[model samples]
Target: MGLVVPFEDKNPDKGASIESLVSLVSADMERVNAMILSRTGSDVTMIPEVANHLISSGGKRLRPMLTLAMANLAGYHGDGHVKLAASVEFMHTATLLHDDVVDESDMRRGRIAARIRWGNQASVLVGDFLLGQAFKMMVEVGSLRALDILSSAAAVIAEGEVMQLAAAKNTETNEDEYLAVIRGKTAELFAAACEVGPVIAGRPKAEQAACRSYGMNLGIAFQLIDDALDYGGTSANLGKNVGDDFREGKITLPVVLSFRRGNDDERAFWRRALEENEASDSDLETAIAIMHRHRALEHTIERARHYGAIARDALELFPKSAIKDAMLETVDFCIARAH
Candidate 1:
């Protein structure tokens, strides 16, 4: 049931460069881009305008690429992958729009957030529109299995958002609780995106499971690196202002670890800074210092590497080829984002 990928070389720290992955799926991605543009259009005009605002903005489009690449890796030659890829992107975009509104965020991808540009109402409505469009495309694909996977993911993502809301500014949120939220909010979609490729490709259950496993673990690593980077990264690294998480009082692994290890005075600082939302400019600096003293950020990255390794290993079912190598390298790249 396993397929062979084009494996040329190996540099575990770095392999299968992103450029190569993009190149491998370039033609299919072009069709996906067209689908995205066409489906976003509407007579209301604002629909397309607001949709394009984020769609046209420079995003790596990594999620869709994963769908397309996984399909290729499974030896799929159908046009359905293009539609599925677009659906994945739309789902991801919808979440971003909703997330910014929920987080009361001002910026996304280095510009003022859509919520700010058009207001929260527009952002939310457009996000809903995108979700509707995503489901429509999934139906058009006519893969009941794929639809079930992605449709369920939408619900899980919503649940994850609510779980995060409940955990927000609550220092008692443990590591397991935080992991559950991310697995739902982030990893669910990744797993679905990768799983559907093999489902449509008619690969065996084992292969489909492998792809799902790869995506789920890769997504966790990606988010973990992001969590660490929020406290320790620069604007360039984060693609948005640093300290946004701290400023918003979002509970992430670094905060959880630091809180668990801190002394009473430090615990009080977390309570005031996070629970009370009293984080001053200097507080972010102090927070980083505490995280460093507690080895929080470093440990977060270490956790990411652990997941990245599992992601890499998930693909061991597939024979070595360039695509498999690239997929494996993506895990390394996700962890490397911390640097």
Candidate 2:
């Protein structure tokens, strides 16, 4: 399927805003928030301090919100979803803490990274602490199937991180390899988050699979847009410095495409900047210019739109409802951020 029609044309009044989804899950999110805060506390003062540093940062909390919304859409009527949603957020936060350390990032949500503030040792240990809390909350939920799904996702996400590390600065990384990396690191948790909604609600296996597909595709689209934004977006929108990827020698799709389309001299430039790690201050500007010349960022966004269409289509199994509409609009909202 293609992405031709704009979200506004499809829903003139609502458009493609996440506010609708946020509002749909607001009450459940309040409980999720409470659970998150309660679980973050620890006797070791540094744990809560480091964890809260990133937790209080102004993230949209989209993954947990998805869990809450999907559970509501499946007609759940219990407190299990609140814990599951909070678990999702904790997993996401933990991933961020660990990722910042791995990526050697300096900023998160426009503030100094927890690793930079507290040091890498503290950041990693607190991430481990959050993972422990997440599993505790998951076990409390009392669903073997849900626990299995999320626990497997944690392993998959770790594998994805290792895969990305192996491929880092390797200009030979292909589209297929990159896709596998994202599926593991980013999409698996999203899939698990949405899938558990139907499991807790006692919905059919088919419904559970559908939500999994929705979350997986939406996550792929989300990451693609994020990678593109590294080149084309501003720091205000990204919550981190633009061109960080280039400076760090990340082998993103934009770099891959530009490397393939560039001439010998341009390829040499990429190898020096990305592989050899010899980028000067002006190199980031050159990287952006090359990506723009080859329309790498634009094509990356097009690929995101493609996955977004699949995410929207995955919801065709469900009947019409406010929650379903909000979910569909959320796909648009994610893709629209690139513009």
TM-score of each: 0.95, 0.95
Question: How good is model 1 by TM-score?
Answer: 0.95
- Where model 1 places Cα greater than 4 Å from the true spot, the runs are 1-16
Candidate 1, residues 1-339, lDDT tens digits: the string is: 011111122324543348778888899999999999999999988889889999887988999999998998899878888999999999999999999999999888877889998999999999999999999999999899999999999999999999999999999999999999999999999999999999999999999999999999999999998998888777665767788999999999999999999999999999999999998988888888898888898888888888988888889998988888778777777777676
Model 2 weakest 10-residue run by lDDT: 1-10
lDDT of 2 by residue, 287-333 (tens): 88888788888788888888999999999999999999999999999
Candidate 1 residue 102 C-alpha distance from true site, Å: 0.6
lDDT of 2 at 176: 92
In order, candidate lDDTs are: 0.89, 0.89
